[model samples]
Target: MTTMPRYLLSVFGPAARTDYGPYPSKEDMLQAFADTGAFNDRLQREGYFVFADGLEPATTATTVDGQGESPVLTDGPYLETKEHIGGFWVIEAPDLDVALALAADGSKACRGVIEVRPFQTAESVAALLDS
Candidate 1:
């Protein structure tokens, strides 16, 4: 059996804010939410959706480091950057072009910039391990 290619559509925005972009009013924000909901429904109906979610602000994040003898816990995002991933969607597509097209719609729906990346397949992982 052939497996579909999985891609991650990450929504990026300012780390300080939970919302995607500047909304002039509450109605605008509600409209954005409605559009995003419609997009999500379309994805599910089309059979390309795997999983999707919006993340909280970077301030609410906790970082855990367990590589050393004792684990250390940090209260915040792992990276201190101007922008962070505010949300993400995991989708299965036939190819990169299709994934990119979907990402375009997703970006518009969520009113945020999106970064599309493909997940490494099991075969690719095994090849890397062997090398």
Candidate 2:
């Protein structure tokens, strides 16, 4: 049987010093999204683009507790580290090579770590689709 081609584009970044920019200001990234609308539209037409989106800043995030006295919800992320996950995508491609090539283009275009991960089996993906 032929397996479906899917990739997870996990956009990672060095959360420490220096600038991660669409250049001019904090909203510049938003502008970039608006500006790339045409490019993205064309990608969608190609049938290789399935879905895409972004994430909130590393701040303004919260962590959850599962087992405890009260299932205690925390006020922020569980941990802090430099490599922050900024955003991601689920795309359709022919194979790993094509997925990685797209990841390279995404990495350069966004100037961040565009990680291309192969989708796991149905068991793993079911949780995502169900939600």
Candidate 3:
């Protein structure tokens, strides 16, 4: 049997802001949230949804490094950047075209930029491990 391809739709925003960037007003932000919730429901009904959630501000993140003899804990995001992933949705789709279409709608719903990317297959990961 063939397995469906998986994609990650990441929502990007400023690192300092927890909300969905600058909105004209509080009502606009609330409308965005409502739209996003409806979009998520549609994804679930269409059987493309896997997992999705919003994340806390970058200030609340903790980074861990375990490559050395001892694990190193660091505060803040792994990368210091003006933008960061504020939320994400993991979805299953037949192809990239479909994923991109879905991401476009998601972008509008959340009032944020959506970055679409495919997950590496298990076979590809095994090949990398063996190399």
lDDT of each: 0.90, 0.71, 0.91
Candidate 3 local lDDT, 39-78, one digit each (tens): 9999999999999999878778999999999999999889
Q: lDDT tens digits, residues 56-95, model 2?
A: 6666577878777777776756778867777777888888
Error of 2 at 40 (Å): 2.4
- Candidate 2's error at 124, in angstroms? 8.4
Candidate number of the best lDDT = 3
- Ranking of all candidate structures by their lDDT, best first: 3, 1, 2
The digit string of per-residue lDDT tens for model 1 on 9-61 reads 99997655424344556777799789999999999999999999988788889
The CA-based lDDT of model 1 is what? Answer: 0.90
Error of 2 at 100 (Å): 0.3
Q: Rank the candidates by TM-score, best first.
A: 1, 3, 2
RMSD of each: 2.0, 5.7, 2.3
How well does model 3 score by local distance difference test? 0.91
The C-alpha stretches of model 3 lying farther than 4 A from their native spots are 18-24, 126-131
- Where in model 1 is the C-alpha error above 4 Å? 18-24, 129-131
